[model samples]
Target: MATPAADLANWIPRLLATWRAARRTQRRGGPRPPLDALLPDELREVAAAVTRLSTGLTRERELAGARYLDDERLLGAYLLFYWPISYLQARGVLSELPRLPRTVLDLGSGPGPLAFAALDAGAVAVTACDRAKQALTAARDLARLAGARLTTRDWNPTQGTPLASLTGGTPPDLITLGHVINELWKGEGAEEKRAALLESAARALAPGGSLVVIEPALRDTSRGLLRVRDLLVSRGFAVRAPCLFRGACPALLKESDWCHAERAIDPPPLVAQIGKAAGLRKEAVKMSYLVLAPPGEPWAAPPPGVVLRIVSEPLAGKGRLRYMGCGPDGRKGLALQEKHVGDANRRFETLKRGDVVALEGTEPRGDGLALGAGSRVTVLAEAGRPVPMPVDGQA
Candidate 1:
């Protein structure tokens, strides 16, 4: 039998190596390298660590019926990259804008990443508020380092009231609700919190101000998302087209699902698009961004096209792979491209693995017609492999 000392000796080097790899990946301006790249001997141990962290997160939320601000630490090494990854998706809309907000309010700004994003986008004032003092402290320290001012508040979702203390006794020019809304809706105190947040954001929004609420698109039936979406719409906010949050759907895409043991990765090009798909145009003060708006403004609209599921053909051509996929509307075809590209864009090349071809043409070839040429599509990967359909069900 292996003695404890022997086991420790055997694992320490691998553990240290993995940790160093994670740290390096964090600082490299990208996402955590695929979980597999960690040394194989260390993978099982790291996987266990990931499982423990995931379990802790779920269990704490399930037990407490609310989020623990400290749990945000689970994202410590990763939070750095997560911001830029998200920014890449939103930049398309933001970059075309003529200006950024002079004053910005980031609700539930744990660690203040969003606050900094707003500032980087040229906001004059970035006020980040969160209920967790520890999280606020971290945010403050970072803000100080960046030479940006931060105002923290004791705003709890359960409070069901605005942090009236820091509303400046007036509305804010821009407000951002990032990831905190869903946390507010997970249990007994949810409805009140949701109502309060919605009402507060609406009432405190400057006449021509905009409110951006972003969250992971993890809800089934888009119920929680739709509730807030509808509430905003009813309050006169318009829904923007192409659900802003589009990307890979994790195995835990649903609210209560949990994974056990070593399961296959849900696969890629797994791109989970998560962002605010719609922003209400406050019309009066006249934001210049409205000029670049795509036809419909402040309206509830679905994304332009359906997601396409692509199955990997690792045996295909040199330096490339073969893929077969179907749109969310159920049209199927084959895609020839690098396995790394996670979404369906015009750049994907034309090739074949069978009858399916990545040629320039409509899907379903006039027979099923799910997606037309030029439709925006996402390609999700499963267990590091791509498939042609959403195995978990419709996306």
Candidate 2:
């Protein structure tokens, strides 16, 4: 069977072709703009429009009332450019779970790209909720084209209702808030609204169920997620990834930095065209995310000596590689000298964010780990690998 990524790679082009044909037919005698002909100025205008929609502390009613959500040109641009990025983000997060969710509830599910990703990742059913009827309609159309199982519901998350109530009494195994938290942050009493939403979502988790929240990698958004992480831990939820212990985030201690992860994605052709036209480089997807389960159902503990999860990009120095990471004990910095790791030095150099590594002869330093010349380094799993659901510490 094709993986979710493979299925999407196959489905997007066909959808784009159909949309292009519809445009041609509608234009009649007039020449239609090529599907990928987003000019540099137009790209910047779109980017500015998106930022306007996103940056405020409250939803920009004027912008929302604009055809931003319903305009065919804008929607097509988003489907061709932004949808792939969101799809990759969803795929990366879902792929890390111990098992595929049988049912998913995607909140603020604009155009339902994430819902499609969940269905492709083996979800039997998906409930996508959004306030924008236009977005939900587009999502429904896309689902039909893709032949996926998805149901749409009208919801405004800012109202702070228990998400399970919207699911008709059948709680989902996975609940996702993708790129929604920041939007919630735009209103008055933002923190309270977020708290209410999270509290309600936590209450909705079934046995072994998980909640995954993803946001943009902006400094404020990343810090906000860290605060949310602390909140979840205080509420007795077990954080499954990115964090190894229930402590204050170490990355936040430095006033100049924030914690986030990066995942590379191969862009579709249309995305490449948009990138070229916009003078934007299509690189790795960067975001801050949290995965949590009910308290008693914590993720499997790491193997002996494999304590730290490298949560940031590795820093390369003269002869050593420095990793900032979180461990079972707390957040710590780990250093590996080129001579000490020997052959594994190459692998160490290539390690991406979110890798689980085992280090030998390491002792805690101020707020990190110190390695000696004889210390050994081993990678248990690279970033984005589907961690096995271990039973009693055994997989």
Candidate 3:
């Protein structure tokens, strides 16, 4: 029942303590100042390192899958800043799962942010797997400080390692690969290889379990995830959330456009300070994620009536409210003129990127559908909440 934000409230200071302890070269006997009260110079230093780390991971592509986290300064920046973001993103995606996961396996888990996130979100058993030893050690240290049980393993999928090696011979209810799928198997036929890895994970899933994939919101990464999604869907896998178009991904019809989701956040104080100094935006969390059921499982039936998942933020126009929605019918433009906006359909004016909306009295217009004054709009699900399964038109 604990929301990611509510649970993360307990993790912020423990993360700070672990990060501070990691920086110590010698044990000091006396009382030392709290690391939460970072000095101006210290903040500036970490911010500069954060800027560099962000560049290498996002823009430069120099540190995408590298051992950047082994470096103390960059690792500190990650633990203090990016770790919270990953935790929030993982928790948000987990919230959309149809069934709460009892056990989780977090692949390529640097410092085990997603691993800890799974624990905080109610997963009883979790294993953080990665190839980097320092990152795994950091994860262990944080677990020690939080008094939470965590498991860590050395995992390198590039060597063609099967997930069974890390599963302790028992499949987890949920397996998460956060921001690490795109970094694997570079060059030609990479999409096929990624799909293969996902297929293996899907085969290893417990009955009614889910394999959750979270990637960065960058254009290339998101498109890559879409391609992998298409491959799995082609392989007869069923997506549990974030996709109503059960066929090929419509977002990949174009080269420039990609799909992603975003949600507003009240970041921790230290994260805000680090963001201010690093020149990064921490106000809203953004990522491309997918939750897929194993083969033979069917997609959840759409609630009665015309339902569509709002897949875009508000598109700018002079007098019309416009968004792109993907549903069983396919992806199409959804428009509502400002003049036609009334009490019934006013909620459509401020829909988020991931909100699932149900409509009544909609008419086909341009490429999609239009809402008139008589139209009624109901939000079936918020950005992170799970969409309810309707029975006899009742949710």
Backbone clashes (count) for model 1:
30
Estimate, for each residue in 267-298, the C-alpha lDDT of model 2 and write its tens digit. 76666666665455567888888888855665
Query: Candidate 3: global Cα-lDDT?
Result: 0.88
Which segments of candidate 3 are over 4 A away from where they belong?
24-31, 390-395
RMSD of each: 15.3, 3.9, 2.2
- Give the Cα lDDT of each candidate: 0.42, 0.71, 0.88
**TM-score-superior candidate, 2 or 3:** 3
Model number with the top TM-score: 3
- Between prediction 2 and prediction 3, the one with superior lDDT is 3
Candidate 3, residues 240-311, lDDT tens digits: the string is 889988899999999988999999999988889889988897999999999999778877777888899999
- Give per-model TM-scores: 0.49, 0.86, 0.95
Ranking by lDDT: 3, 2, 1
Worst 10 residues of 2 by lDDT: 56-65
Task: Tell me the lDDT of model 2 at 14.
Answer: 47
TM-score of 1: 0.49
